[model samples]
Target: MTAISIAPAATRIPSRHRITKVMRLQMVNRLTYLGIPWIITGVALVISIVVAVLISVSVPEPGRQAALEGMAYSWAGLSPFWYLAVVGVQAVSAIFPFALGFSITRREYALGTLVTFVVIAAFNATGWAILTEIERAINAAGLTFHHFTALWFSEVGAGSVWLSLFTLQIVIFAVASAFAAVYARWRAMGMLVLWTAVALVVLGLIAFALLTGSAVPIIDWLMGFTITGFFAALLIPATLAFALGWAALHRAPLRG
Candidate 1:
């Protein structure tokens, strides 16, 4: 009689485990995601300080306080937030193909990318909040330098600052992810169409505002929102963009 042989069955990994693994894979390039952004922020802070000093020295004595107060309105401290959007694009355009080659499903990759965004947003938000407090302390010491706590943060508490930063980071990152997903699925033409549509929508909004004569009122209403409230309102668009990105990735080609 001939001997019979049995083949072992393939073991399936749990969904959560696979998702976490993909997240870890996305975080492999720490310098791109973390280091460069902070470096840019540091450089921006230094530049802002130098500018503040120069303004203090060059301006007439009576206007010195006014110039420094205006300097407190600078947006240099949030420089890293814009860079995070580029990081988001890189996360999808560069990393997706590698993950696919490793047998990662599109769903797993999407979840992993989203989780990575959340982690990064939280980390950066915490850092920004801490820096805001430190900036406040420096200003308190009669330095008159303000970088991290500019704009609406001039009137808000620490918790509001953190919430605003966290929400804004999510919104920026998610929007960039959506754009990157479009590029991944359709390349240059896709990006062109996306930008064209964006421009059209912006023009339409501008026309509407001009025709309706509500521009000033709209601006006033928007400016009326508290720091926390404004960022909270951003959650709506953030959710929509995040969902669009996830959906786009599901059909993206591995080679794009």
Candidate 2:
């Protein structure tokens, strides 16, 4: 008799619950990807300024070679503009992955993120570059990327090479992450071509360094890597992220 009694109640999902969950996830992911790079860029710039000032005051105004030595040890020095390279790339990295869900398919979601990424890259890089220039003027080392590269490739001791390695890793990571992110979003052939050209220029810089036996090689490589590797790398991931997003946005439907 008890077994025949009642029917079960149907479940209803609250819209707020769904909205909150998605919002929370997106926010967390945004912070993880965007926050990390931004902080690094800022802190690096600060350290660079301090080190540059210290070098300027601590070292005696000397000959060209001595100036070179001081430049080598200086922090962010004259490359704060390099942050555009980092944060700009990071913008693409943070949002493209989110495109995988396609849940937020407004035109704004698609284009806005890229725009924002570009803005962040540009703003941060510009600010950093300006600050770096100020530092360089104060210190007056006249160092070049080529100079740094020569030290990196030479048979210098580990201490000499570590800074180069750190720089290379940071640069590569920023560019790679940007490329990967762009790839996840869409196939922007024009942008890819631009990046490819940029990367090639980097290669050219390398060639120039080699010809001159200067530190410029690393800068060349980084330039080449950015335009070429990252320029095009963004395309592939962008496609995947778009495809998945499209699928998710469309509810299950019957095949015609």
Candidate with top lDDT is 1
TM-score of 2: 0.35
In model 1, the Cα lDDT at residue 73 comes to: 65
lDDT of each: 0.88, 0.45
* Per-residue C-alpha lDDT of model 1 across residues 1-256, encoded as one tens digit per residue: 7767676767989999999998899888788878998899889988998898898889989998888888766788788888888888988888889999999999999998889888988898999899999989988888777788788887889999999999999999899999999888888998899899989999998999899998999899998987788899999999999888887789988762
TM-score of each: 0.88, 0.35
User: How many residue pairs clash (N, CA or C atoms closer than 3 angstroms) in each of the candidate models, in the order given?
Assistant: 0, 29
Q: Highest TM-score: which candidate?
A: 1
Residue range with the least summed lDDT across 10 consecutive positions in model 1:
1-10
lDDT of 2 at 153: 29
lDDT per residue for candidate 2 within 181-242, as digits (tens), equals 44444346634864897799889977887888976666676567632344345545444544
